[model samples]
Target chain A: MMDILSEMLGYAFLVRALVVGALVSACAALLGVSLVLKRYSMIGDGLSHVGFGSLALATALHAAPLAVAIPVVIAAAFLLLRLSQSSKIKGDAAIALISTGSLAVGVVIISRTSGMNTDVCNYLFGSILAMNRIDVYLSVALAVTVLFLFILFYNKLFAITFDETFAKATGVKTGVYNMVVAFLTAITIVVGMRMMGAMLISSLIVFPALTSMRVFRKFKSVTVCSVFVSLACFFVGVVISYVYATPTGASIVIINIFAFLLFWLVRVLMTKRVAVKKPGLVLLMPLLLLAACGKSETAALPEGSAAQAAFVLEYPSQRGEAPAQAWLRQADTQGEADAATPVIEIKEKMFITQINDIYLNAGDYIGKTIKLEGIFRLEQYEGRQYRYVLRYGPGCCGNDGNAGFEVSWQPRTPAGAAPSQKAYPKQDDWVRALGTLQTYEEDGYPYVYLVLSSLSVLDTRGAEFVTQ
Target chain B: MEKDRPKDPQGIPSEPLILCKNLSLGYDGHIVLRDFDLRICAGDYCCVIGENGCGKTTLVRGLLGLISPIRGTIAFGAKIRRTEIGYLSQQEAAKQDFPAGVYEIVLSGGIGAMGLRPFYSRGEKQKAEAALMRLGMAGFRNRCFRELSGGQKRRVLIARALCAAKKLLVLDEPSAGLDPLAREEVYRLLKDVNRETGMTIVMISHDIAAVEKYATVVVTLGKEINAVGVGGEKK
Candidate 1:
């Protein structure tokens, strides 16, 4: 079991996956408290569908998914808020209209182009391995930011969520704060889509909050407990998927379901023990939970073994020898035809596949040099230096996976041996390194590492964690 | 000469704390009340009495700055900002399903003072606690609001409004859902708060008996401020 765990961590994709899963779940839980309490949990479902449509359109337009989905979902959220507020439509009706409409649009676009393939399935139920290096970093940064802002504005949000009219009467600027809530939720939904899938992502936002509400009544207690329970359920779900080989997104959702049920049972037992039969209180609990439950109907019900099948999903291999005809075509089109071009300029989104191909066919470019930029780090094992060029991006569903490569760096003056290079380049230093590929045998397995001839720390300007 | 006299003839400070002059109130351009004129002075327990759909609630809402006047102006006194007036909308305003403690409900009264600041200050919490104590609900601060009796909930709500109200309070149908006993308790509580604190109160109610018994001033609405009464007598 330990060997399996270590082996899973050995893959950078898995590490990135776990990091993103933790952050996304934390964010979902924190925001979920207010959403659930305010009876806006379905907004997550509604916005996720909008995100799906936006992502499908972005794919059709050949644009970045996050870049396009973020703004589009935000606009949809505002539209939902406005429609719900108007006398023409009530709450659930407005949500249903927008959610189904967006879902239909997404399905239509996907069928037209991708032909309703596994990519659509991946978007619906999540594909954990599909994440790349940049996704993990972006998720981490954004999730932390959401957490900080939520805490900072906790009182105002509480006021607005609980009693919006009173909040406005008190000068809370309920409209602006409502928009802020919607905007933040959209960002979270878009970021979480790659890992949780458009269908199952809202479950992370709804379950922990509903579950915590059952056990706790006060807003602060419910919110704080929700954060803890959300993180736990996500971590456990990721581990369960890893050990049982279940679908990542569905696994996390299953864990949340169990937590919800467990909390219900505990509350029922506690209430029975106390025998506090206050009139209408018992009937209202189920009604409130049911209201929150209806919006989550589309998430995590059917995706199990079929979801796993979709997990390993990709179009049939096009090339037998190279197996990366698409990547080669991309490299060729990017004006890298000259063999002596020294440093191949790999674009941001293409970095993962390029590194994967390079690692697989190490002998193809043994002596040739390359240059890249990423967060730098140093690790030591048995008196040998194991410096790495690390970057995290979107992998398959964000459950318990990451997409990045392990580029082991050979420092010019081995940091561990000399101890002087440590002052220059430390962990999290964004530096550009010029290096040559070196392959070696480790424990009878062929592994790829890099030997750097020149390394320079670039000025930290215009540095973005998410590459378009 | 008497016809030209101010509405209140008791010489109880003729200037009004809030004055609605020829105000027209409505929803979506449909006028409910037009050319409405009403005056509420400082420390007045003013009860707005009217038949069903006569726009008593609309007048209260307009006074609280919740609705716009279509034709005329509703002006506030120098002492009050729009946010400073305490408003307990209705018994149905705070839903029974809301998962909040009595203390939280009261604390929310001070939320207007917070503005853009993220968290409530220590002073706000103290004010909420003080409001709870003032309402004789000190021990019930931690009690779940949903589990409370209708009368208790109304008191808590009033206390919450007191936490925010510097000069005025406006309540609409506060005793609508309560039983006879609960309704009497609520009326008595409102009366006591009015007489003791000298706080201006504007209430809309169908209970004419209670209105006759407790109100310092009464205004009957029939598409306008039809009648003005002082100390239960028409001026």
Candidate 2:
């Protein structure tokens, strides 16, 4: 366990993931108390779905994703607030309608444009590898801003959440404070989406508050305990995910569920002393069972080093074109299309699938230099250590898909400045490897590989996962 | 209560603190009370008596400025901002389930008077404590509101109202669910508060006997202001 912990700590991505998780956890808990008390807890789910749709739209339009998503999700929050106030639609029903509709729209957009690849799937389930430096900085800035604003309006929020009518009667602009709450919640959801995913972000906003409420009766105590509990749960969840290779978002939510149950159990045990009554035990049973169902088989790393195997940079075989680009090259099959077709440039959104397609059909692009970025995984086969650039794509859910390209050093690094000299990346270090594409046969099947001209281990900590 | 007597700059005791002229009150464009006229003087202990759905609650709400009047003008006294008149709404829907202590609920009453300040000031806390003490609920300050008996909750709410009101208090059915003894106790407390401090009190109730015994003024409501009379007035 210590070995795994130390090894995991060596990677910058893991550190970035933990930091972002903590920031978001604290921010969510602070707002969660008010949101839960106000009966607007589901707004988190509503806004997250809106964020998913906005993220998909931004990805499709090739816009700066957060820039597009933040404003759109904030607007959706206000819209939900207005819709809930309208007599025609109830609050819960409004949330359900907006959330499901936005989720469906997001799914449709992803399927239409990105063709339902791993990148899109990551957004659904979340990937810690998605946290690059930009994301960390953004999360930190926004999380701090949210925490500050929440504290600035803490008392007013307490009044509004507990008794909005009374708060208004007491001369509070309850409408303005309500808007402030909604706006802060929207920001928390959108910023948290990268690490927690659209599907599970609401758990962070709900479970901590509920858990704290189970034991504490005072609003101030509940809020303070909620922040501490949420941050603790998130820390433990991240550590569990790191050690067991579990899905980060689900692990965090599962931890929160357990914390809630534990707090409830403590409450039950202290019932004689505390005079507390448990109201929702019957309703909680199935929910606890549902949370338990989040367990999935841990994804394993791929084995066998491609470095020992002789790689021929030249392809003697003719596979007309990569299957993804087959339609564009259909007319050129007779060998007259070299000059007519431009090289297919792989974008971040489609990099995983494109690299996979190129590997599966390695004959089309032999000498072309392709630039790709992913976590670096080092494995040993036949006494030769090989570093593979890997990425986890959407495969049903968080537990399943692993797709990546093997990096083959051109004029392989001299033995003197070998693995010992340069710290070979641990299992999940984000790196940008630029190399000429090569094909090598393993057993009998040919696989596309990268022959590195220059490798720069990218510092993409807090970076968003690629979603096309 | 003697030391805390209401300091009204208008020395004339008959001056109205709240006046409603030809008022129509209801919700959503449906008028419940039409052409209702009433005057509440600074030291009046007014008991508004009515049958169910006769617009007593609507009249009180309109007077509190919670709802707008359909036609007439309801004016506040010179120094009275709408919020300065403390109001205790009818037993809110399952408010006992709220996770607050008696002290917290009482302290919240002063939230409006806190202005832009985020935290309660020392003076506000002392006032809340004094309000609790006045209702003989100082011992229950830290007790959870949900665990309190219905009668205890009423006293706490009355204390909360005291925290908000500087000159006037309006309560709607403050003794609705209590037993007769608890109801009498609450009535006595209100009567004392009104008599000793000269804080104008308006309450909606069905207990005509209590109203006759405790009220300085009585306004009977039925579709409109049916009767207004001075009952057991000190003057």
Candidate 3:
């Protein structure tokens, strides 16, 4: 373990990762307390998506990601603040809209752009392992600025967070203070994005604040405790990632989750133990238990044994179910089949199959004869040629699952007879299309293609996915 | 009855300390009070009385230039500087376990006077200490604001307001949640400050009995100034 630690410390990238992680954790810990107190916990998530889009655009244009991301995130923060001010849209709704929309736009742009080696997944999730000295510097600078601002405005911030009208009446510039907070939040998201990734970044912003609040009472203590908790999580995560050779970002998030659970469990156990000594403690036991159970259930699981165990624990009945056995049915006998039916020779055509399983090495079998299922997205560019994108509607396809792929094909029928060429199937409509496999280059990137021989729409309706 | 009414102060080019003409106050566009005109003079201890949402708080806010009136001009006297206005809102129970000390909260009152400068001066610190001393909160300065009882927090907030203001003071529901002894103590403190310093005071309260006893000028607000009583004289 020491050898691995020494090796990790020797690498400049690893040092950068450690420094950036610690800085981001500190900054996030301080700001996150206010967010949690205000019940605007999702602001971090939304702003991070805005940052992701900004970074992608900057990368595509060969500009500095931080420069582009900072302004964009600040603008998004202001926009969110403005939207939240409106009586029509509540706070969470505005956050969700901006977050999802920005991420969607980011993914679409990334899909179209070339020559940019930036991985969408890494940005969405996080890549602390890939940090450089510049990233470290940015994070440190941001952390110090946030810390200074926090200290300078500590009293006013407390006053406003608790009660805005009172703060304003007492001569605090509530509007300017709020704007400063929003700006700080934007900076924190942009700085932390490299460490936490857009998706899991909010976890860093939320988890430590929540855990600290469980133990600490005062705002100052909460900020201090949250920073300590976040720093501990970051260091432990880095060390564990280095020792286990796991993804650093995931390792960090998992460490936070573990700490959260441990804190929650300790809280619950203490409350229960206290109940035995004092009956008044019994009143708090249920709340404590609920909090502990809630955190353990909600904590993001790592992509290994821990996750598998959590999945099993969540669905015990499903876990006990036996795996399906392959059937050994008898093959059709030549004597029973009126054996001498004349065989018709059919021409072998290249067909493209829908992506049934993206989790496997299905790319090698792209041009091979394979059967798959998906919905059809039809497009018209030239005469009577029905070009479509073959897609599968997975649960949370855009957010979590790699749901669909693009496919170009021509229907067998002449104009007007082929499934209303202008009327494309709505997204996530289940369909099956038989097509020949063809490799082609579009915008300087090779893609597997399927030329459709036949197509039929299945019974499944438009996109089916559960949303929280 | 019209002939017996007091003549309106018409054609007075110079502004009063607070002048509201045909003003309306409300949340959104819904009017809570209409056609309300009030004129407060320098050193006038104006106590406004009404039920919740009856525009008492709104009137106080309007006078301070925090909220714009829907349909009127709110003019302040030429001598009345904007920074001279100090306001204490209804005392909310501090989350009892908050981290900041009483001195820290009290010092926040001087933030506006300091403008955007990074640090506080020694003079500003001395003034904050003086304000706390005046409020009888000198010993509790090091104690956390969250650790104080209901009345202590009020006194601390009063110190904060004192630290902020140069001349005028506005308080909203200062006696709302306090016991009778605490409420009387607050009233006495206000009376003593006004007598000694000659500072302009405006307060919002529902305590009709107390306002009659303590207010120099009592303004009862609803659709309009229901009555403007001078000292103990009923209108």
TM-scores (chain A) of the candidates: 0.61, 0.65, 0.58
lDDT of 2 by residue, A344-399 (tens): 34434334435544553455568676666677887777666667876654465453
What's the i-RMS for candidate 3 in angstroms?
3.3
Ten-residue segment with the worst summed lDDT in candidate 1 chain A?
A459-468
- Candidate 2 residues lying further than 4 Å off, grouped into runs, are A1-9, A272-468, B1-10, B13-15, B93-96, B179-182, B195-197, B226-235
Instruction: Give the least accurate 10-residue stretch of model 2 chain B, judged by summed lDDT.
Output: B1-10
lDDT of 3 by residue, B1-235 (tens): 0111122257333235777788887667877778777787666677888767777877777777667778888787787766676778874734543455678777767666655665678887898999888878899977756658778888888887777766788998887667898788888788777666767789888887777777777888765575464634543
Clashing pairs in 2: A118-A394, A131-A461, A131-A462, A131-A463, A132-A460, A132-A461, A132-A462, A132-A463, A133-A461, A135-A462
Instruction: Choose the strongest candidate by TM-score.
Output: 2
Q: Write the per-residue lDDT of candidate 1 for residues A14-82, one digit (tens) a residue.
A: 677778778888888888988877778899999999998988888888787777898899899898878
Query: Residues A1-468, candidate 3, lDDT per residue (tens digit)?
Result: 344456456544457667777887888888888777766678888999989888888877868788889999999998888777677899889989999999877777776784223256567766543433465577788878987897787656766776566566655677888888888989988988866788888888898888766544456666777887788778777666544445567888887887787666755775667554332332343345435533443353322234334433542342224332222011112211332432211111101101322212334444443233455555556544434544322222253333334443432332322353323345544445444455555446555555443344444322222111
Per-residue lDDT over B1-235 for candidate 2, one digit per residue giving the tens place of the 0 to 100 score: 1222234566545677888898888888998998867888787788888888888888888887767888999988785775676778785623344577678888888877767677888998999999999878999987777778777887887788888887889999889768888788889988888877778898998888887777767888774465454532322
lDDT of each: 0.70, 0.72, 0.65
How many angstroms is residue A27 displaced in model 1 relative to the true structure, after the best TM-score fit?
A: 2.2
Q: Candidate 2: which docking quality band?
A: acceptable
Off by over 4 Å in 1: A1-7, A111-118, A275-468, B1-15, B176-198, B227-235
Residue by residue across B1-235, what tens digits does model 1's lDDT show?
0112233347655467888788898888888888867778777788889898898887777776666788899988776677677878773445455667788778888878766676778998898998888777999988877788767887888788888876677888778767887688778877777666667788998999898777778888874466565533453
What is chain B's TM-score across the candidates, in the order shown? 0.84, 0.88, 0.84
